[model samples]
Target: MRDPDAFYPGSRTREEWLAECAFDQACGGATITPGGAPLPGTEQAEQQPAEPAPAPAAPDPTTATIEDVAEFAPDPPQVVGEPDGIGVVGMPTNFVVDATEHTVTGDIFDIPVTVRFTPVSYVFDYGDGTRRETTSPGTSWQDLDVPQFTATDTSHSYGEPGEYEVGVTIRYAAEADAGGGWFPIAGLLELTAPTTVIRIVDVDTALVERTCAEDPSGPGC
Candidate 1:
């Protein structure tokens, strides 16, 4: 209950206020003259108890923490294309090959080469002693080298950094198999080597065919 003499700011207790209003003589609860009769209808009105303060709303369910904020920070660094944009044919030029952001990143990339000679045999030499001997239409990194043919895919990496001339030499042998079936081979292009841990490229031209005789006496021998 609030003390009326205490200089408090707000209203007094609900009960006291109600009583003050109910028994005030002018508002009608006083007794009349001689008979001491009550003035009228003002007996303290029934006071309703204050509604229990609403239970403090349950603290919002949450686990906000440093880890939670860190989890949603931002993105990490990234390099979209090949390192320095290095490119290769069927072999590595400078020994070093462009490593896919992933191969170096654990992702592997495979390129294909198709060989065609009217009706003879064409081989894909992976430059690692392994030869991909195939009919006309064929796959290089297949069989993995043996009586059949070297698999269509080969893997190699460079040791150091430097300008390396990597390329493929395609030779059209006069079919050591066929009595006379040959064609001009190629692979005489040059380009800058990539700067990745390990990169690979494919080519389709010269190798070992140094003499003019190896240059196909004609077009299709």
Candidate 2:
């Protein structure tokens, strides 16, 4: 029998034939040169360097203004006291107010940002034609090492018996941080505390000779 390889002299092998067919199909049946090289234009296209991947877009600016910082300011101040509802005429009543720090976080122009609100001062309105402003919330008598019913920096005395409303306003300073160091925000913002009412009454005293133990129901025991 004749050898299969001798059937076609000067013809390509089966692998070469399949490869040429695949190339023809890929190039839409375009003609290939003797060494199976692509056409001129096709060779140029294959040799051309690919464009560098587009650089990632730069991040947007994180600029902020006082008004923008104000948007994240702290809530109203909280009033702290012991006898929150009662007071005595001609007596000293201690009052204190404070506000907790708050962190405000959000996006500005697609860039993340953070701002903090810090309390600077508190303004107290006694609602009886008297007002006081303090840099720090005053401490209690025990904490201040002072005696009870004594006048203090944050204490008030009532001259007449009546009901009075008390309130406080907190002022906050803002600072912004956006990938860089924190910077103070211009201007200040204020928030008012809820109104609180106190009833003031007068007290009278009398001296008795008998001891409170001797007279369980004495007039001024």
Candidate 3:
């Protein structure tokens, strides 16, 4: 029948109370504290320590404001994509078996390259000769460490166990190719030719991290 805020001394809002004090029982269920004195068994209230707040989260992917484009952006990255942005030369076209815990690390570009930053989407041609597209990638550098970036395609996580190949293709912003041709830049980047990689099996993981340890047989392998 009394105000809920009148009882909780540390907070006023229901949200704050729910987050900080609801689980805590040191307050002795005191619905009210007249003259800041405990209504009843409030001795533990003074003895209890304040709970530490949770750590802040990493940046969110949604509802974040971003630059619409990188027009005339300085010192832009060199994009060594499929020559003309088709899928390119030596990418992880095929997959190889590795522990699921192992973080994949490899460079798939012939060299770093640059782009106009005017692209609707991109495709990645995994070396084994398969291609995948981003469907509709909204241009934004907010999600990546690099600037003036775009999402070509994402890697597939093997939910269970299986072999798979990977590839990508990047569709440019130009509706038509050079000289007003629909199939223009595709030929330039060799769109018809998707990059290639062989099949790779996902395996079980034991130790994702490693410490210094010499083989029992010798100093080093």
Candidate 4:
């Protein structure tokens, strides 16, 4: 048989051809060049052991901060007045809000993350230049087993009769869970609930000989 190396432009032996085939198989199908040198990118592939998929690139790992998860925190339900937006002057108008704990799931740095928000405290703005902060969200008089217009932790009394816009700010303590167990984030996030308008009116009291039902035209009826 004629020398196969004579037919080729460069000198190469059958052993060299077999070696190149073996290299190609080892490198996952890298093409060989003249003189038995593998292609540019394939050279490294052929020499290096098949690297393990880069180890999945590891997770971002940077711990999330409170500010990072603030956007996901939703405002608590608006401050609910016991009388549904109407209160009498000089009487305590009870207030209550839904301070339920909640959780939100989203992606942070392309990693799955879950955030939990717990209402820590509440700041009530009575809109009469009066503000009160309380740990309790306060319950209605009925819920508290009391009569209406009764003073409660969240109640406010207006000195004068007027229309006021009541607002509440809920401070939430946040915790994060990124595949690992839940961990607390430093600081608290304050979310403002929608303002509710309450009408405050003045009333006069008078002693009558009979009830309004008995005499519709009684004094101060």
Task: Point to the candidate with the largest TM-score.
Answer: 4
TM-scores, all candidates, are: 0.17, 0.65, 0.24, 0.70
By TM-score, the better pick of 2 and 3 is 2
* Candidate 1 segments whose C-alpha is farther than 4 A from its true place: 1-55, 58-72, 80-83, 87-202, 209-221
Write out the backbone clash pairs for model 2.
none
How many clashing pairs in candidate 4? 0
Candidate 1 lDDT score relative to the true structure: 0.25
Better of 3 and 4 by lDDT: 4
Model 2, span 1-221: residue lDDT tens: 43232111125432343233221322112122233323335434334358665544344222244466666676676675545567788998888776777898976555677877766667778878898887666677788877777777777888999988888887665555656544444445678998778788899978887888999888877
Q: Least lDDT summed over 10 consecutive residues: which range in candidate 2?
A: 22-31
Local accuracy of candidate 4 as per-residue lDDT tens digits, 1-221: 64322211123342343233221322112122224323335433324467554333243323345677788897669788868788888999988988878899987667788877777678899999999988788897887898898899999998899899999988776666666445444456778899998999898898878998999998876
Q: Candidate 2: which stretches are off by over 4 Å?
A: 1-63, 211-214
TM-score of 2: 0.65
**Range of the 10 consecutive residues with the lowest summed lDDT in candidate 1:** 100-109
Ranking by TM-score: 4, 2, 3, 1
lDDT of each: 0.25, 0.61, 0.27, 0.68
lDDT of 4: 0.68
Candidate 1, residue 52: Cα displacement in angstroms equals 2.7
Model 4 misplacement above 4 A: 1-62
